[model samples]
Target: MSIQCPSCNSQRIITRDIARKLGGTTGAIAGGASGMAGAAGGARVGTLVGTIGGPLGMTLGGLAGAIIGGLVGSAAGGAAGAKLGEEIDNKVLDNFQCANCGHCFRQQD
Candidate 1:
């Protein structure tokens, strides 16, 4: 269902899941905070929250949420990223590997 990295056979690829988790958690916290604030100010908090939850909602919150999300995601994804890298590395190892040099390479016609 997914394409493996040409250099690595890893299926554990970086995907929207990572982004979504990072983005979602951040969006929720920030949106919730701002939504609460806007609600207090007589604006439609629900609308703002909805918007915050849409299309990288963190974007709406600006750099603060983004930086926070990135840091959190990076930390959370470190092990996951390594796992993905390992899986890709294994895949690359399996798919490539020059018969002569013991080096991993893509097959070419």
Candidate 2:
């Protein structure tokens, strides 16, 4: 769909996406925090498996597990947040800017 500025009636428009960016960051932080549980579980499993090799292997395994768990959680959370933010941007926020006049407006249905 084409976007036009209400004030200038200019066809040059851009999306601000302010909420999407914020939501992704916030969601990532929250997801990482929640992932601590996953990390702990991963560590336990990794340590058990690494036991065959000894202390050094166990240490490495635990570290790897924690990192992987946290990363996975953050990724998942970020995606969810971005989706929600996009919806908000489209439906509730004035997410578009007119490149010609610097006007911000929401798209009308």
Ten consecutive residues with minimal summed lDDT in candidate 2? 29-38
lDDT of candidate 2 over 1-109, digit per residue (tens): 8888999999999999988998898888878877777889888888888788899989988888888888888888888888888889999999999999899999898
Clashes of each: 4, 0
Distance from true location, Cα of 57 in model 2, Å: 1.8
For model 2 the local lDDT of residue 29 reads: 82
For each candidate in turn, the TM-score is: 0.29, 0.90
RMSD of each predicted structure: 13.8, 1.3
How high a TM-score does candidate 1 get?
Answer: 0.29
lDDT of each: 0.45, 0.88
Identify the runs in model 2 with alpha carbons over 4 angstroms from their true place: none
